[model samples]
Target: MRNVDIVQLSVFVLFLAAVTVVGFLAARWRRGQTLMHLDEWGLGGRGFGTFVTWFLLGGDLYTAYTFIAVPAAVFAGGAMGFWAVPYGAIAYPLVFLIGPRLWSVSHRHGYVTTADFVHGRFGSRALGLAVALTGILAMMPYIALQLVGVQAVLTVMGITGTGPAADLPLFLAFALLAAYTYTSGLRAPALISFVKDTLLYLVVIVAIVYIPARLGGWGNVFDSAEAALSKPDPATGRPSGSLVTNEMTHWAYGTLALGSSLALFIYPHTVTGALAAGRRDVVRRNAAMLPAYSVVLGLLALLGYMALADPGVVAAVREAGNPQLAVPFLFDAAFPAWFAGVAFAAIGVGALVPAAIMSIAASNLFTRNVYTAFLRPDATPEEETRVAQLVSLLVKAGALVFVFAFGRSLAINMQLLGGIWVVQTFPALALGVFTRWFHRWALLAGWAAGMVYGTWTAYLSSSPAQEHFASPLAEIPFLERNGYVALTAFVLNMLVVVALTVAFRAFGVPDGADETSPADYTADAADRLAAPEDPGRALTGEGPR
Candidate 1:
């Protein structure tokens, strides 16, 4: 067995225990009449203001995998990893535009998931089911990667054992996550996010400042990193990575940034965070404030270069044969045991916050769009909430199973795969908020085309370490340049949508009814109050208000 640092482990456990208590207590943080309604349970009563929404959205988007993987990407591939920084910068402006609209519509109509909006907007259950399934499917790998993030931190702490015992800690941690998430719903993550983001900010600030001063200076760190990155890998004769993008890589980098930005808020977890806001202005305000995280993300990405600067960290990561270990190993080598323990706790709690939100989001999709729409059209608010809580546990458990069954590569591949699938929903969800000119069938067809092309293209991609699902970039057909598969597929999706809509309109195909009003997209909290008392009737197009 590997020797564990007792001080590091102790600090980690103490923080984790504290957060567990906070999570359970969060059930009463903003107590409602009862947690038996989707409005209250899944969306925290839609009462979160700017401060809580900022932390919740921050905790939701800047995940633990992000904490580990972004730097690891830089550690493995140099400048390309910094694409996340620009991607993050670009995403929130889009959020500033899209978020208030989504919140407005969801709040007005009692929509819990993006699929709920799609269903009401298009008046097509089939299209709604398509969106729901895609969200759940895309989220599985994402949730699993959070577990992978926790496991990476644990592995660096020397918490290892044989067989099933190796994953006991992971299982226990997730069990704690599942319990609070089940009991407190979205409120659990929202409350704990205050702690999660605080620790993360503390860790990043200290690492960026203290680590550089310790390693000679920023100049020495960059010089060492440039030297290390320029060296050729033994597995391939080509240079491992470069500090700047070259002619051949510019297209890939730009397209990656664009695709990732477009896909960021489309993820169900992000939508969940946005809809939890008390007012549309809360979503808008949080969007403007959230860009502050991009600055931190850029600084965090520098840790990759910092790790490369430190021979001890590089050697430790090399010995482990996993690039994901780069940041953790850097912390272990650079900080004293006790501080390193704090950093580990930051990563662990970071995983829990996002993981909790992801499972809740997925459950909301299943319960709102799938279970209620198909299984039991007459399900009460209480039954829907119960089903969502149960499904949240199952989602987390499924992610745990996924981590052990698929091994480590799935974590590496998750961002691109999830982006590829989730971005396909943009037309029905994002664009639907603006216009409904696109035929429902056309949108569904476009989604199908994108899903197939993206999945197949991603499957054909290969890398030195793996045979399939190995890269996010592929050769664009007409452009004849390497770019993000998600963007290329998204282009194809749009084309199909346009062509099919024109063709269907030319043929006079019947377009589905739209239940939402133009005013719904611009409605505020006061407008929601003035609207119908029973918004569920609006969803089902039942009795008159």
Candidate 2:
């Protein structure tokens, strides 16, 4: 490892302190609001306008993981890594369809989490519990991946060390994160996202345009990457990378892109940002505008190929035994110390935005679905907000444990595993918004089957480099060819759901009560759904009376 660059470290520290201040002050951004309620604390007063919502959702969705891992994947897997570009491109269209409906129903019903929607929509606490558990489980590794991004920056900056002492800086950073998130809640991330996005946009644009010029232009960069990737790996006896998906990878790439697009908005963090909007139109507007990030993402993926063109970077990261550090190392080697620090800050701040949002999303799930629904049915809004605040800190602790235990070596695999677990909820949560024809029991059973199959198959997949959680791709059962494990499991899940729904109907098994009206699914911000109805004084994005 090289000696720490003081210039880069100083710029990074300055950015970190600035965002921390922003986070704490965010609680007062909209003054006179009592943040004692879940609506205020967990969803940022549900009053972010179009401009803020765009930044918030973009920061939340694109994430530090996208900034770090997509490039790392390209560095490691070649053309297959570019699946993120298409997946990101297709995601907003899917969000455009589902976002308004979810916002409408969630607004009309005062639902804070998807489990709250499921519980109220189907009147089945058991099914809501299932969804809640699935969300919390999936979010743990996803949050850990964000920490991995931060850790990569630190590692490249020469701040990371071994043992408990090595993690002190990370621990201190998250402590600050937990404190501001506890004080300001969703508003912390919302307010800080502006700064994060600014730094990230500047860094990514420079890396794409300026770096290629420094490295002998785009043509040379691509040629170098292709030459490197075409060489066969000594361990696996397969080509290291490719410019396009071949017979072996086509199925996995296509399925991963499609399935990830379907699952994107269904994750609790994604919905948390959507529902935080002040108006239904905000969600739709953001959906149309969010594709701009995908353009940046496509540009960002090329940095991986840029790294491959640098033999010094490839050798250093390979010596360090982590592929996820590729982008950070690339920036460190190619840029001056001061500019490199700015790039590191971009990634570090990028991780903070989504990490805060995800912790809130998971905590909201626990507070609404588990704590109140099971332990304290008479819990007040103030109590719910308090529990969520406490749980947010706990969620961060869990993510820290996961990162420390698993280490950075498996960051990408763990994220893929998280996706596999999360997508199983699609048949229950996402489909439930459009139709109530699915029996709650059938959906639950299908979720169970998919979770089991996905997990077991993922466990069985081992490569020459690793013994478990080797890759997201696996052979399709009975087809004897490789595909994304999550998508393959989801197909089995839907088939089981269909078969069980038919049998349950024939047996006259009761479908749970649905409290939502058809109009509720399409209600807009202008509708009377915003009027005071429930005694809890639900948020209408106008602040408390």
Candidate 3:
């Protein structure tokens, strides 16, 4: 940007260079006998211990989205935006109960993706394919949210205007993201996470301390937010929009949080981060420790009130021309110049770490589940790796399309829609891990029902602020508008499965054979002796049994 303070720009550049090095060098950190295998290139050889997974999962979940958007929500809405705080709080407990089971089973079977577990457990290629497709599709918009996160920061840092320079800055960002992720695989993002998270913690902690003190105190912060929420809607004279008080908001917000946490671990990208761990315990420890990020989330949401209390932040954000820049503008104007530089880097680097992980996760699904199963069943590991790399590029391109396609509000909704779609995979993929008694055809029927119903319900929801479908629910005559779209779709999915299951059983439709047994789903350690996938074999997908 034309007005960027030279000192802050230098600090920000230093941070960017550091992240680039971490990404490029991550390839060498965990050496596999073969680099081409899905297990190596896609997963970092499945050798990361608790410390690495701690960073990896932390990197995946908290993300640039949490850093930028959550605060932006606070800036726009009020207390209701803080729902993400409770969601993270509720997520770990769910992960604790379910993650170990998935790990135990996947390790036993050498499963590379959640879809792989579905394939072997239910013996249904179609159901496995649905899981893969949902994951890839959901990831497209979710990954784009990270770019949105970067763009929000860039907007504040003077990147966007009515000219070529605005586009140049973003294109440069894309080049850097593509370069690092391509070189490091999962390792690059995981390694970069340490610095990114540290910077985020520093920036948010400083803002929390400085902003509240400058405004007054927590009491004033709450009072200011309540005052804002109490204002009559310009459209409706009533308390317009949401005010996060009492059990109504509580249940809606709480369920949204829990359901999201349940869905989070099952998301292919999140699971991909976990599966790279050296042991199941690492997964467990990270599940517990990662919630520490939630505390920061709570503070970030509170910054909305900080912005509300300060006219300067409001004026600065308005000047920048986007609500997403509220937090960044507050930082630059409120804090000293050097600290603002570091905070900006926090958001920028934060984007790269999650971007890299998402690209890798999407790539793994393509190489292992799609190409191997349908296109070329005889493909080797090397082929799988090559194809995975190609697909990773395409995935990023699709995500870029999404990033450009929507406004911030729509982007948030699309990201939630992505989550809703991904959550539908839970029945076939997550539940299948515990048992295989459900017929494969039943699972497919359930998946189809869930997809159709979830999409339709989302489409039905529309607001003046949003097109297509908005706000997750509408106050309809017959239906309650309070709960999650995913929860409703999941209920419908299960109903279809039960109905079809009984029919399939009475009719004696044979459940195709599962190669894996219950005991096989419980192993956590990798097979050190087995040969890793070669480049040709890896990307094209087919591999040795």
- Give the candidate number with the greatest lDDT: 1
lDDT of 3 by residue, 354-419 (tens): 878888888888777888878877876678778887788888888887766655643456567787
Worst 10-residue stretch by lDDT in candidate 2? Answer: 534-543
lDDT of 1 by residue, 361-456 (tens): 999999988898888887888899999999998888888776765547336567667899999999998888899999999999999999999999
For TM-score, candidate 1 versus 2, the one ahead is: 1
Which ten residues in a row are the worst by lDDT in model 1? 529-538
The pairs that clash in candidate 2 are none
TM-score: the better of candidates 2 and 3: 2
Instruction: Give me candidate 2's TM-score against the actual structure.
Output: 0.96
Computed on alpha carbons, the lDDT of every model, listed in order, comes to 0.88, 0.85, 0.75
Task: Assess every candidate by TM-score.
Answer: 0.97, 0.96, 0.92
RMSD of each: 1.6, 2.7, 2.8
Task: List the candidates ranked by lDDT, beginning with the highest.
Answer: 1, 2, 3
Residue range 1-545, candidate 2, lDDT tens digits: 56787899999999999999999999998733488888888888777899999998988887877789988889987999999889977778888988999998888767889888887677788889989988998888888888888878888888866678678766876787799999999989999999999998899888988888988998999999998899888777888779788988888888889878877898999899998898999999999989888889889889999999999998987898788989999999899999999999999899888999999999999998899888877777788889999999999898887776664664767678889988999987888889888888888889899999999998888877667777888988787778888898899899999999999999999888787789988887655343332312332123232
TM-score: which candidate is best?
A: 1
**Candidate 2: lDDT of 534?**
31
Where is model 2 more than 4 Å wrong at Cα?
526-545
What is the alpha-carbon lDDT of model 1 when measured against the actual structure? 0.88
